[model samples]
Target: MVTIQGIAFIPQNISKGGEKLYILNKQDVPIVDGLINLNSDSSQANLSEAQQQLDLLWNKLDLIEMNDELKAISPAMAQGKIDKRLIIVHRYIRLNYGEPLTLQLLADLINCNPVYLSNTYTKLFKITPMKYLQVTRMKKASELLKETNMSIKDITTHLGYVNNSQFSTIFKRYFSCTPVEYRRNQHLQMRSIGIF
Candidate 1:
């Protein structure tokens, strides 16, 4: 059984080399950004139902055989395949920046080993995945500080920080100012410009 974001599936027939199955979730499906440990019996039952539907669909579709030319392509030529997964990871980080995220959890979400994912992501984006995640969080926090009246503690908790001090520390490290100082500076700048 393989699960992505709490949705589980049982592969009826998996090839020795593994088959790529692209899943497009519905628009309304709640996106889970955190780690989901599926150990309950209900989760198992849901997986079984989903697998039955997938198998039925597979049996109904006509399978196509790849040509020898396509089959002859080396694994090195297939490097482009990782590009989409990397983009997905980036989008997930942007959407779920408030969620608890770690290298292993992100790799598990994408079905890749953490080391490989880290190396490939860093190579392609010129930034480590965790670094990117931190940047995303900080950016969102900055926006919240500039635009909202939420307290620093509230903002910190909203961004999934364990405490105000840690949030303030990271915010200062990233923006060269603490949250309160940043907000005060923003307001002062706006007032100086006669916009407040």
Candidate 2:
């Protein structure tokens, strides 16, 4: 299968100028190779159809780029390109905090060396990526504890902890209270506010 996804962004300047315009296109098509004999008439027909679709997509992209609304945004996008590697790492951590994560795994995700990723991430965020993962996991665990009826053991397991004791130790070190205490305190605070 082949999928083409497009997103359009209006620069800050354009927004300040009081114009809102965007064009987004998303489509998916199944592509099968070796489905018919190479010289067969059916194969030739399918190839022609695919080529027409691709040409249409390119025409649309060209039109969008030539549009005045997109012209105002293109230069800004070109001038202020964000670091894709950093975004990828941050998103991976946020989405996968419940899974076991390691420095090497994060580096692999961004196709960079572990040492380089660690150094770059530390410089950009003032904390190592692994530490960020740990903090993220702790934050999520804290939220789950306060909001759900899940037990300590379940929360620990959900956050990728090997055991409840280890989870409690780390949770205490990070939040200055064990998970149980934190949950109890949250409940008491909620009650005081007439929420519980």
Candidate 3:
């Protein structure tokens, strides 16, 4: 999912997360649809036009009145002209982040060399595949800790960790708190803001 500006945009099925995001204005729907349709075209000329469409999207977005309830949608269009294989690899990572994933395995998804995949992925996304997986895992762990009542062991298992200590160690390294402490802190912050 791509969150442009402050709006949540789901790139479900095609790439990234599959869950839907917030409600968008009726007028803005066409802009989102246009961009999707524009970028999905692979012809060189249309792809160039798609870049213009993306630019137009930014200009149109500046006029949107954002609110707590706004939502966005997309077909997982990679910005400008991008290698389609990267899109496939990206979507796979998001959908299967819970599984034991590796750079070689991700490269296998496209029958490409691991080194080539690593370099291209890093060049395009500005992060290595393994790093993205770690980030994605941490992000999922954070969501589970704050939003679900799953136990630490259960969460660790769901995240493909072999044991709680390993998960806790990584969690603390990324978040500066253990899973339990993080959950408690989130609850405290929510209560302070009247969310509880």
Candidate that scores best on TM-score: 3
Q: Which order, best to worst by TM-score?
A: 3, 1, 2
Poorest stretch of ten by lDDT in candidate 2: 27-36
The C-alpha RMSD of each candidate to the native structure, in angstroms, is 17.2, 17.0, 15.3
Per-residue lDDT value at 122 in model 2: 72
Q: Write the per-residue lDDT of candidate 3 for residues 83-187, one digit (tens) a residue.
A: 679868876886788898889999999999999999988876667888878877997899788867999999998988889999999999888999999999999
**Tens-digit lDDT string for candidate 2 (33-133):** 22222213346576566546545555554354345433444454577643458657966887888888888898898888999888877765556888878
lDDT of 1 by residue, 38-111 (tens): 21223666546544544443432212112221343324347655456776786787678888889999999899
For each candidate, give its TM-score against the true structure.
Answer: 0.58, 0.57, 0.60
The clash numbers for all candidates, in the given order, read: 0, 0, 2
Model with the higher TM-score, candidate 1 or 3: 3
Error of 3 at 148 (Å): 1.0
Q: Model 3 segments beyond 4 Å from truth?
A: 1-81
**Local distance difference test, each candidate:** 0.65, 0.67, 0.72
Q: Report the error of model 2 at residue 156, Å.
A: 0.9
